[model samples]
Target chain A: MPGDDGLRSRFPISFRFLDRSRTVAPPGWSRWLVPPAALSVHLAIGQAYAWSVFKPPLESALGLSGTASALPFQLGIVMLGLSAAFGGTLVERNGPRWAMFVSMTCFSSGFLLSALGVATRQYWLVVLGYGFVGGIGLGIGYISPVSTLIKWFPDRPGMATGIAIMGFGGGALIASPWSAAMLESFGAGAGGIATTFLVHGVIYALFMSMGVLLVRVPPDGWLPRGWTPARAAVRPLVTTADVSARNAIRTPQFWCLWVVLCCNVTAGIGILEKAAPMIRDFFAGTATPVAAGAAAGFVALLSLANMTGRIVWSSTSDLIGRKNVYRLYLGAGALLYLAIALAGDASKPLFIVAALGILSFYGGGFATVPAYLKDLFGTYQVGAIHGRLLTAWSTAGVLGPLIVNAVADAQEAAGRSGPALYTTSLYIMIALLVGGFTANELIRPVHPRFHEPAAGAPAAGRPLTTEGRQS
Target chain B: MTTEDPAATGPHPTGETTGETTGRTAGGGRAVLMAVGWTWVGVPFAYGVWELVRKVAQLFAG
Candidate 1:
């Protein structure tokens, strides 16, 4: 009878190996193992960046328009936001292993479905499979390792997250060339595209499985060697108190962060979405006109900047504090936009340097926000709160392209050429950065009302169950 | 499950279990895992960056 009570107390449900309870690190499990586990899922899902490599082939092979070819990518982005927001609480409840498993399933299956669609010449199926199903994988996979890494490496949340996020940014670097090679070898026809998709699905599934298997929740009271609560709370914004994701949405600080993320992303994405053509247009009339190949190079350079900034600037946040790092992102970002606007193509070096600076801040902004969320809100439901905050990214995804594309179109219609076409958009981006800077200034800590009482006291936010302690 | 296990304690309280005290698994396998984990993600990432740097060189060469 006592054994039965002990057994019931140890594991509420029959001890399944895959349970969140089972995933708890067995004392000596090296915390170093966690980041790579996080990176596995992130790197695999980050292939979302290479969606463009499929576009041209898909359009030609399927006899679709440019806009139609783009539907899958757009829907995927939208789903990334939606699934992250809605699935966040569940992710927090289920633990990283479960989330990673679900992500791998959805993501890999998305590729398989796309293969079927391509083989059958059903374009709509491609949209449904790659855009919707694969997108859920992207969303869930994106946040899976976030809070776990924070728990394991509270001393270096910024750096830990930056490492995994950098994987996402760099994913395209691998997928782009790899997919191109596959298309080249596979013939770029429907059959070839289908084979490529099939291969991609199988490969990514194998890759992401590493994360699902390797990820572990830290023990309830585990702290890094020499790290303590007082040490972590030395920062002005870093809170020792916890905030539930449900309560986080109600706070003004959350909205302020939302504005900051949306604005920073909008400014950066506007330039990124049109990086290749923008550089060419900027120098079209100059003595040194940028060639098409050079423009492609510029886009590649921006990708490098974007990828590196996630690690570099986000790691910098650890020493400088999240607020100060963001000050650099917004304030310096605004100044860079101003420099680009004023310098124009008068100096190619100035233009390239300024764009790179702006892009670094953009990638830094994405990589650092999770740490920022952990700072303002506590680690309790930080992943869930992070998931909800991604809605800002979705909003900016639409807003950024619209502002840049629309302004350029209007300028072209009005007989503008070269730098003239983008001048208004640049200025508009500068204004948005200024607004984001103001929002960054406005972010105060979440109020006590929003804070989830620590495990023992009357459950303030949610029930203080196993899920509550899992964080 | 009862909330009594030190493992089930609330989100990070002050120092309860430091990494030094928690018996570390000392073996070749743990070392191997650490190496393999980093290598698995590291190789592909390095390849990606190398490919990108080549393209980046083209931009500067122009």
Candidate 2:
């Protein structure tokens, strides 16, 4: 079933084993197994956040600037969006088994190749390895579990996705300290970096295998026990109609959600990119000012907020509709920014609450958006659609830092001190959130004309096979 | 909800095949297996939270 085309066609030998291994779940087999399967892959790839841990060492050992050292991580994120967007159709047709295998190979090899590069002192090899090769892994791996999890927990798509995505945020927490420890012991040289990269590659390949083995598509008519399509449809703005990935991109709703995601991510990332420095600056004029170490702690607390929000807020979305939850994310996020901006360094507790609240909503935005896609577009090709939507993240990643850093730098040039430095950026974030809120309000059900025809229409919870894939 | 894959095609990575078709209360060995699976995800999160809490405590400790 897996090795039908694309990479599967090229690697028929491996696909043969993987395809048979990833059987659709037999009836009455537990659906609960699916989340862990998804988490296994996400937790491993989520280590991308800890790429910064490699930065200081890489710059020192390789003799490069901060911008040059950041190139591979930046390129990795770029390729992540591109590969997922382009390869989504193949992923849908080939199924999660094939997708996971490709992710594992590319992601693991990226590290191994980086290991070789570090050993050889070739910066380009490191770029090609982690940036080009590993990025594709991030994209494929990120989306691989998404559709499967939604299928399993149709009753709670937001919560199902939250569980997996929370691992992505948590991944950095595990890796940042772990990689720091490794570099400390191994001496942060080219050999040490290579060792770290090699270990990451090997361990991730083994770890992600758990996802490949554990993930399953539902049988053609499977639904959770005591949950039916009718019960799920009672929520507003959700539809039973399916839109193929190709056709989905043609609709206005797709683009609107893209804008919504871009704005929300840009706002949150604007704050996150400058978390340590921003907190320190905000309290610099206060009596009990924040030290550099304390600022790092604030960043850690933001990470916690990010991960906690992914689970807590997204689960809350299951109770309230997807639209309403976004209303809170974008709407309340603006208010939080206002509080942070107007209050300045007047109070420590207010600054902490405002920042933490904003970070939580940022995490909530990522975890909530997929479920929203499921609601608007149906589960058909949702992974693919979600893949395309990740371009929003790439855009925000670049835009967020550019805006925050540029404004902060400009303020510093004018000899501005303290919270005034972030003032303009905070207001810009508020504008971004408000823009995102407006876009979310505009999202509506896809027009039925785009729906797949009756005879060949995919039943809810069934995998969408490409026409050529239907053996 | 469509095809009912039979038990003969048993045991992928999760060794629990459909052959031992226990009643559908979502219990027995499967529940234990579920606990193990959930814990696989939750344990790291617990550690991460513990680490963050320690960091957060520093803001007040000073």
Candidate 3:
């Protein structure tokens, strides 16, 4: 309720014109423009993945340990999960324009403020700036375009969401080398890092504003040319019935999907977190072993797989259906993990292919979940629901690395080395994937009781609610 | 059952949903939005893809 006009009133007068609630797309506007708007924000915040580029420099300049230097990025992730959960409803209420603007300001300002922190050598300032303020921007920016995209492309929610989420993964790929080059050019000192932060802030703010100007919500009941709601609803998992974000969370389907995402992500992160070292260990005894540079290359390849999988797999979900697609992700993913576990560097090519497939599913898991949410919960509060669901990711982020790293450490201590170090972790991941597959299999159509009753149909179990909020 | 309701027959059960802007594109505005949209989405996306390709190339080149 506080989000409606209250959120809009918080912004300065000059910015009100950009708010989606007040603005209108000109006559003859194409729905095609919406993805760019969503991408603009995603590409900007996706820089979170590239924070490692700054880590070595920060540790060197500040004389901080690796763990200490990583605080900003870690806290940024924690805050991303927290703020998205808290601010999700507000974003839904205030509209995408408002959310995008807030994200742009907070995200850019986080960089600017972190620059100030670096110039002064105040580590806490960097932590607060990038982690707390910028993290909110990441969370809001992530969800801002999702529901709108789902609305515009009701026929292809998975595909629509995939394009935008792929930007987040790609953002890191672009920013990693770009940020590295900037630091190199400017000199990898405190001054150089500060300058990079400033440039990033200014550039991202400018880039994200494009989305602010270009994005508009589709008019009510608008469908793509030659599309009908009935056709899209034909799938077994899809429902024409809408559920509010608030109530959607109460449903068993939401938690089942939540567990599904958590396990899938946790399983994938096991490999992603240790790609470089794991590859080196697996092939150390080979005639032409994996070198450091090649190990780094292997890591880069995984990133490519991550980005490609988001677009390819999620888009595929649109055709084959979300449930069936996830069946492939978790089902195939488990088998791949099993393959790696059993093969145990017996064949290097087998390890590479299996790992790539796993990473692809990792990225696909992210791009596809929003559509899954839209299927179970209507677009009314899909953004908010998605926000809540991201806690699964946050949970997995910690769980994944912990399980993998912890197991690897234990193996080394026990005098085990090479492929055996990862053997147990791989089996664990397989089990987790199997768990996710079962959860996915358990998903059924949301019962009629949860559906917002149609007006002409007469109010059934639930009241005639629109946009998930009861009028 | 509400599932059989005429209102449920469409995308939104209530028929009139809030924040729905029926964007009608005519000849000129539609063309401009299309060009602008593609360029806007395409540039950054292409750049990202290009960077990724180059990185992978470097990985193999080594």
Number of the top lDDT candidate: 1
Task: Please provide, for model 3 over A345-442, each residue's C-alpha lDDT reduced to its tens digit, 9 standing for 90 to 100.
Answer: 78988898999999999999999999998887767788999999999999999999999999999999999988999899998999999999999999
RMSD of each: 5.1, 4.5, 5.1
- lDDT agreement with native, every candidate: 0.86, 0.82, 0.83
The candidates' DockQ values read: 0.26, 0.24, 0.21
> How displaced is residue B5 in candidate 3, in Å?
28
Tell me which of candidates 2 and 3 scores higher on DockQ.
2
Cα displacement (Å) at residue A274, model 1: 1.4
Q: For candidate 1, what's the RMSD?
A: 5.1
Which is superior by DockQ, 1 or 2? 1
Top DockQ hit: 1
- Residue pairs clashing in model 3 are A28-B24, A28-B25, A28-B26, A29-B25, A218-B21, A219-B20, A219-B21, A219-B22
Per-residue CA lDDT of candidate 2, range A230-262, in tens?
887887788876677877888888999998889
Give all TM-scores, in the order shown: 0.92, 0.91, 0.91
> Candidate 1 lDDT (Cα, whole model)?
0.86
Q: Please tell me what DockQ candidate 1 reaches.
A: 0.26
Q: What is the lDDT for A233 in model 3?
A: 83
**What lDDT tens digits, residue by residue, belong to model 1 across residues A364-430?**
9999999999999888888999999999999999999999999999999999999999999999999
Looking at model 2, the pairs that clash are A220-B1, A220-B2, A221-B1, A221-B2, A222-B1
Candidate 3 chain A has its poorest 10 consecutive residues by lDDT at A1-10
Task: Candidate 3: list runs displaced more than 4 Å.
Answer: A1-12, A455-457, A463-471, B1-26, B58-62
**Model 2 interface DockQ:** 0.24
